[model samples]
Target: MTRRRRTACILAALGAGVAITQTACGGGTPSAAPSTSYDATVRADSPALYLSLGAGGPKKQKQSAVALKATYHHAPGVTSMPNGDRASLFDGTSQYVEIPDDDRLSVTTTGELTVEAWIRPDALTFAKTDGAGYVNWLGKVSSEEARTEWLARMYSRDNSEARANRISGYVFNEGGGLGAGSYFEDRVRPGEWIHYALVINTREKSDAYPTGYVKVYKNGVLRDQDALDGYDIVPSNTDAPMRIGTAAAKSYFKGAIGKVAVYDSEVPESRLAAHCRAMHGTPREAAGT
Candidate 1:
């Protein structure tokens, strides 16, 4: 069976409370599943991806909950969270995760897309080849020869020349041009976990032809929205890989990344909050620290 079909069957069996058993082939021992109930809950969410970084070795870190294999660049290390969960730490130079380009990841003009993650930065400022700059937490883009498709980045008011600490989201067209974008000027505290989510609804009606709407959510609250401008807000297809912890080596993220999720459809605000609560505990719990 195909991977998607097998995943569906596994979820169905789990929903039905069927006890699953497996036999080792060729006299090899069967691999053990996650031991915690919370892990099971996360797996059942069925995100297009659920990457639990720093929870395991490099090989296992690349394994997605939905079976999509990811690759690590420059070898990020594991770190501990306040809740005892592990997170992958990126060094501002050359650490990030790369997800191979796939058709499912390419957002079209009529498709809905959601990207969410939990991040804790060491510092907002980093030195680049040209000069000092901020970091892009996650994004997908063509090679330097091509334009960026989308990016969720952290920048400063002075455009990284100085540290003002702002978070922004951008959507681009095929030729690597900006389409729709917005930024939140909230100050990001170092070493504190924050939930970030971005939703894109390309089917929404807009005055601009062939463009759609975008929303930025920080910790379950809507922070910004804008209508995409370009005629090709998102290409019908792309072969550019989705990147985490950096975008095309420009702004490498320097911090710990816990959970990363992608949904083919826009997730409800309530549901997004619930997911954050599940992964990071309550806001009250966070404030206590």
Candidate 2:
């Protein structure tokens, strides 16, 4: 089937809120749980952090069903999704969510990690001192000193060689200057709700590289990937806490952010796709895969 047709089918299934099952990459078939029930089912499979920006206002949003139950320091403003669900809106200048640093949220040199989010940006570019630039969707960095440990953000169209509105994933080791970081890239459009995921498999070594293999997915499909090899994307004990809608004071995202999840283990390709389907209001069985 064509990409357009496949996307249409997935959206249709999501709209119906149908629950379906599909086989995970490793083994047995796993059920595609609805977004509402995701915390219970998916979280049970592995330790994770789940944040649902639902009908309530930003101040009312809370971490759901996770062991740590991290709290969020949200800025003002609210927006509605296509489904009429409320989401937190960030205005490049100050709107963002700050989650305190936690050991569980940190990435290591030899473990799997996954970060996923649902976002819809008002504009791809935001104002900066030099020129217009993109913003970060989610990040974890140190505030003491300007250091980015790990983050998923849109590349600065005015400052980088990357294509306009491209999404990039970054990782840096502790005490390793920003130059010691590695990144992967993909593209995204503004004003549309999209599911973005970053999967890092540290257990598997790449033939051509030394670090972990990384994959970036959009709408449940892999779009870009690379190996961390020389760059250190993992964080040490001193790294900063994870934040949503911004990375420290800069790169504040200008958009409405919905569900954000962080998994300690790499999410299987099938399950990741199912989660994306659920976010769009469709059931996996209806995807016709």
Candidate 3:
């Protein structure tokens, strides 16, 4: 049936307290490059979860992962415009979702990790008011210690220079508690299926921190890349479920989320390409009905 409904059904069957893992597809050619694939845990007879945004949403692919508790699609504290259909999760005081519901996946990792998702970004209404648009892709917890690391997420903002240049990408580290660090922008459009990733590699050193990076792919092709070497942030454990819609209460995403995949290791380009090719029609990054 529909993607959301299919996932819901699978979640129902699997029941709570069951730990679902992302595994390799059976009989499928092993990706030449290193990659990790995640599918929802289901009964052998259950259908696949392969739904997307535009059409009836994503469909049920044979391999899909069930979302755990506190995974909110639309909760309170966030506002949705009249024309929008999806609900966002902004804190009552701020316009962002940077913290977890109960601080479940706040562990720090010592090595590399990857983040992926299918997002339809909405208009940046709070850009002017807060000087920061929506950055609900992903985020880490707030650190009280000055030496604590950070792994924030990306979002889009309006460029006053050009009307067509309506969207861009940026990140905030915990160094300044969401105020410090260099904030970059992307020359991309909103309301479409875009693939974005943040890869942290390299070893930590006394002189310099390990090298990390950020990249954006429009419909599968790599459009932007950033080398964030010397920056270090504690990562969540392998068991931590990836946050899709909103990272915290303040930076809730204002759009429809179709699919999300998390790999313990870096995902190969071939697999990413396959996922991009599987994508269907365009989706507006608008609030939900």
Candidate 4:
């Protein structure tokens, strides 16, 4: 080949290298998740952390919107997402991601917090991740004894066939480990994509929901509410790293996880529901998978 032609080809290859992975440059998939209508809404509110984990299966996606990167484990599979996007696939055994601890995660005082994720749990039966047989998916609890902050997880069939694959949102106190949790099972369809959310407001105290309260959502709709009896939050435990697809390194989630965001403030019900709607532009369907 001519010298000029060879030089041009090398430059062309280097230009495509901007993607997080080599596959993004050659594979048919695009390098990022498409923008959604709610992107503006989330951007306006400015969440403390937001991760678009499906940037063509990159080990890390630049957190341009919120400035947070994720470290993947065991090379989870990248699968085609329902909304014309891509997501990280967990083997239901040992794949997850971990983000370093940051001060912004420590939302204290009237511990207002909102955690959201778009997940498609596969049809396979997940094994026990914790003693309770629940696979913790996301949150701030570093370990079983590390400033137990909060985590979002799914129930394994080992706990109860009836409650298997259900979604639960739990929060705990920092030093001690007292906790409160709420769950929703109607949304557990082994093979479909659903937007899930957990909202907590600790402004007021209630005997039933003593430490505060938590609400679980499916496809942006409220499914259940429960108390977070962790004797008031111990702050957002800085020592505890922000984790996804697993909690306390005990429970690991299987299936696809994408489009994760964390806000240190309580989000309104209406807006929370809108987030799910904005993600998928299709007609509304029933909850069951």
lDDT of each: 0.64, 0.60, 0.35, 0.65
Better of 1 and 4 by lDDT: 4
Question: Compared to the true structure, candidate 3 yields what TM-score?
Answer: 0.48
Error of 1 at 10 (Å): 35
Model 2 lDDT tens row, 55-75? 333454445444443344554
- Poorly placed runs, candidate 2 (over 4 Å): 1-47, 55-74, 82-84, 128-132, 144-147, 156-162, 176-188, 232-234, 282-289
Ranked candidates, highest TM-score first: 4, 1, 2, 3
Q: Could you give candidate 1's per-residue lDDT for residues 17-100 as a string of tens digits?
A: 222222221223221222233344445555677776754334534554446677777778887653446678888787778887
Q: For residue 59, give model 1's deviation from the true position in Å.
A: 3.4
In the range 179-245, model 3's lDDT, one tens digit per residue, is 2122334444333334444434323333333344544444444555544442333333332223444
TM-score, structure 1 vs. true: 0.75
Candidate 1 Cα errors over 4 Å, as ranges: 1-45, 55-66, 129-132, 145-147, 156-163, 206-210, 230-232, 282-289
TM-score of each: 0.75, 0.74, 0.48, 0.75
Candidate 1 local Cα displacement, residue 174, angstroms: 0.9
Local distance difference test, candidate 3: 0.35
Runs in model 3 deviating more than 4 A are 1-67, 73-110, 124-131, 142-156, 159-190, 203-212, 230-243, 281-289
**What tens digits encode model 4's per-residue C-alpha lDDT throughout 1-289?**
8966754543343223221111211112221223443455455666778876764333765576446677887677776544344578887777777777766665573378788888777743676377657787888875755576777878776565567667888777675365667787763556567678888777756777666688887665677887655445444555777777786777678778887888878877677665654444321121111
Report backbone clashes per prediction.
1, 6, 39, 0
